[model samples]
Target: MMNKGRLYGVGVGPGDPELITLKALRLLRSCPVVAYQSADDKESIARGIVAEYLPGNQIEVQYHLPRALDPYAAQPIYDEVVIPIQEHLAAGRDVVVLCEGDPLFYGSFMYVFTRLSDHFETEVVPGVSSPMGCASALAVPLSYRNDVFSVLPAPLPAEVLEAQLLNADAAVIIKLRRHFTKVRDVLHKLGLASRARYIERGTMANQRVVSLDDMDPSQVPYFSMILVPSKSHL
Candidate 1:
């Protein structure tokens, strides 16, 4: 029987190439096969972050997962990606899946990990998440002295988003593209709008950090996030 190869789910960090962990870089250089999620346009932010480390002649697998919010629509794409990955593992070739942030933190790597772990040896390497990167970019303390931090995905219904924002000590609203208007409305309703700061493409070269009040809401990008500190802390 041939030996099976291992699958490594590696987080390359939020955006900055310097943010990638040394372990992730090492694996990217050494892994025979590299997999990453790209858009229909074939652009991959995760791959761009670690592009410098990818060795020449390395096998690149680009999974063009949809950029939409519907997970149901993404299932078939995930299933398609699994086939090539399985083939690599069966052939005893180690595979490295590039993730934009911490693999399990709202990252598509979780889907791949769950699907492949039962059949293959898998490992995860952690990296700096977007919230951390955004906080650093804004020079704001995320949480301190028993402050509860909430990381909410903006796709949630307005009521749920409002309820969570009301309960949170410090909150980070992620995935703010199409949901930007709704999230901004929820923040305004909670009286937290004035306290919110928006960070777009955190840690990237063209990053933008501004007061949420100044933003148009509808004009924000998918990579944008909002940070709201607790009233007590303000």
Candidate 2:
């Protein structure tokens, strides 16, 4: 019997290819197969990030995980998409599943990781997450000593977001594509609008930093973020 191949879930960083770690780059290039997920109609963001570095000899596999679905309803589809990666692993071909940010941090790679890690040898490489990337681009300090930090998904109810904001010293409001206006209103109501920096495609080549009021809610993209920095200063 052939030995099974090792599985790698490598975080490619928020958007910048430069942010990929040395270890991740090594594993990514050495792997016999490279994989990432995207919609049938869209190009893979993860693949685009590292397209320059690929040796062009590795077998590339692209899977599709639809945007915004009921996870329960999407489970079967998710399960189905990962079968190709599993087949490569079973054939003793090492597969590197590329993720946008940290693989386990609300990453789509989690779908593959959860499915394949149990059956094969697995490894995960950490990368720069969105909060950190956005904060750097904004040049704002996120948290001070003992300051609480919160990651609030914009999909949550306004009341719930408000309550969470009231408790944390700093926060990053994400998943704001369709919920930008709601999050903007909450920030204004909570008097955090001034401190909240709105950026779209943060750290990407076409990155845009716009004021909260200036943002066109309808034009918001999936990669946008709102960074609320801590008020405390040393």
Candidate 3:
């Protein structure tokens, strides 16, 4: 029997076509099977990014990852999610799974990769992450010389968030949608609200960037991200 085929976990970059790396674009164009995640719809942002590079009538697989408040409860959903792709890999078909931002950065690719590793060869191509793109879209530096950067989930407790802000030279808080108001309160309490900046939709066409003080949560989308650059260390 032929060896099980390799898997290409391609990062489609952060909401921009040109941002895709040469390596990722090349792989997508060459792969017979291209896969991506679809949430509540058949198409997705990540899929749109690589659409140009894909072959006509090529095999396109959509893996549906469960959208739940808790990642643990969603484990079973993901297991069921990758089964079709796994089946393709087992049949010796090289599959390219398109992911948003970087494959390893808070992405679904990691979940599938971890479970499918024993059965097939998997390669992850790093792409520009959302935070970096968010920073770039604002024309601001995420970190300066000797600056420390910490990435934390927005759902972190108020105290934990405060302590992290106190120590890091710079910090990025992701998943800012549900926790936006809480994160805003913590920043305000720590007197860091003025220094904070929010970017919604990152590098996408509808992206928005502004100082935290001026932001209205109602205007922010679920894809929103916030950055707090340390002014004290300057």
Candidate 4:
């Protein structure tokens, strides 16, 4: 008879390897099986961060989960991607799933957890999230007394973006790479452009933190985020 296997959903922090939590590092070192999502690429930030911590010759699995443009076409992705990983856990192998930022926040690990937790003993190890890294890299306070903050993605409708920007004292907009120009225009229209600081690959080797006025959309990467704080509230 074999003991039941447990799953550890590990957050690797934003980009810096040193930011990984002690608990997360421990799991990576002890766990015999490791997994991380690539979506389409072979290399992943989450996987790279923990590679140093993992013991040599450990079984490592990388899932290239589909990122289909249409939700309807992605159902097969869910089935094919998660089923095999679940099987590995059921075989009594401790598995660690690597995620960038907090595992539960906008992370693909959530998808796996939701699918397999009913049968496995699952745990989540929190990491330093991206918003904190971005703010610290910019050397700015995220909020002042009584200031409300909103964190939203760039794909949100322009009208909604406008409303949130108008009301929130401080805001962090993620997923800004493709929508950089539009987001920039909205910030400028609301007279908050000067206060907006864009951080690209925050805390990473090629990290770039600059004012929105100086950024060119073409130069921004998908990992970029913009932090805008209202002057009136600050």
Candidate 5:
């Protein structure tokens, strides 16, 4: 009987190629099939991060799990995207799936993990997530001693965001694309606008750190983040 292939969920880190971990690189190269999230026209960010390291002869699979949809309603969609990865594993060929950040930390790989972990051997490699990457790029401390930190997605309603901010000493605002104006207004109302720092594509070659107040709402990208660092100083 042919043994089933092992499945690996490898985190490629934020955007910098050097951010890839030794373990991730090892498995990434050893796997016969490499899978990543991709759009019809654009290369996946996860793949782009480690493009130079790819061996070039391995079979590559691209899957897209659409965003902004109801989770319950997206089950069939998630099932459909992972079919390519499952087919590779079924053939007894080890597969390495690339994730932008830590696999469990709001990663796209979750779709694959939830569906395949029960049927196949699986491993996940952690990588530097957006908040940590942005904090380093901004050269600001994320939290001080005894400080509470929170990750607030920008799509959240103003009242909900305000409440979360009220309790957090430090916060990272993510997914700011279309919700930038709403989040900006909420931060101003809570007197946190001045303390917030904005950046786009942190740790990448095109990284840009912009003052929060000066950021144009219409121009915010999916890779942008707002860091509200702890006020306490050492």
Candidate 6:
């Protein structure tokens, strides 16, 4: 029997195409099969970042995993996408799964990695996470000496969000789509609203960086993030 091909989870960074690691670029170009998560409309942020690196002859696969409020609801979509990936590995054709930010950091690639790792030789190429990218874009330091930095996904309940925000010295709230108002209100109540910054499409060409005070909570994208700097450091 022929040896199975290796699977690579490549993080393409937040939004800047140049932020992609050299190793990731190499793997993307060399791999025969390239896969990325996309909407039903076939749009994928990860694919856009690595588009230049993908060779013309490479077989591109888009898994239409629609954005959802409940993460568990996407399991069925993952199951469907895994079949073709497994087939490629079985055929001894290496597959590169494109991911945004670090593959393991609140990324869809985690779902794929967990399912495929035991069955195939897998490796992860890390990239700059959105929080880090947002920090750079806003010229804010994420943490200072002895400062605790927390990362919170905005999908949690308002009470949970408030509790965590109150305890952390600094925090980043990600997935700030429809939950913008709730996150903003929580920050305001904690007296950290003025200290926070809102960043949309960080490191991208059209990136927007604004103070949380000035931002209108209603009109925010899913790619947005809120950076709450450490009070001690500030």
Which candidate ranks first by lDDT, i.e. highest?
Answer: 2
Tens digits of per-residue lDDT for model 2, 1-234: 999999999999989889889998999889999999888888999999899889999999999988689989999998999999999999999999999989999999988999999999999999899899999988999999998999999999999999999999999999999999999999999999999999988889999999999989999999999999999977
Clashes of 6: 0
lDDT of each: 0.88, 0.93, 0.84, 0.84, 0.92, 0.88
Runs of candidate 2 exceeding 4 Å displacement: none
* Residues 105-167, model 5: lDDT tens digits: 988899999999999999999998989998998889999888999999988888999999999
- lDDT, candidate 1, residue 123? 95
Scored against the true structure, residue 183 in model 4 reaches a CA lDDT of 93
Off by more than 4 A, model 6: 69-73
- Weakest 10 consecutive residues, lDDT, candidate 6? 62-71
TM-scores, one per candidate: 0.93, 0.98, 0.92, 0.93, 0.98, 0.94
Q: In model 4, how large is the Cα lDDT of residue 176?
A: 85
In angstroms, give how far residue 58 of model 3 lies from its true place: 1.5
RMSD of 2: 0.8
lDDT of 4 at 141: 81
TM-score (C-alpha, index-matched) for candidate 4: 0.93
List runs of model 3 lying over 4 Å from the truth.
69-71, 232-234
Per-residue CA lDDT of model 1 for 1-234, tens digit only, reads 999989999999989999999999999999999999877675899999888777788998887656564778777777777788889998999999999989988888888888899999999999899999988988877888888889999989999998888788999999888898898888888778888888899999999877777788677888899988655654
Question: Which tens-of-lDDT digit does each residue in 1-234 have in candidate 4?
Answer: 877689999999988888899999999988888988885646887887776777887788888766534666766677678876787888998999999999998888877888889989999999899999888877778888888889988998888899988889899999887789999999888888878888999987789877777787788887899988545643
Q: Backbone clashes per model, in order? A: 0, 0, 0, 0, 0, 0
Weakest ten-residue segment in model 5 by summed lDDT: 36-45
Each candidate: RMSD: 1.8, 0.8, 1.8, 1.8, 0.8, 1.6
The residue pairs that clash in candidate 2, if any, are: none
Task: Give per-residue CA lDDT, model 3, range 185-214, as digits (tens).
Answer: 998998888888888888887777777877
Candidate 1 stretches greater than 4 Å from native: 67-77, 231-234
List clashing residue pairs in candidate 4: none
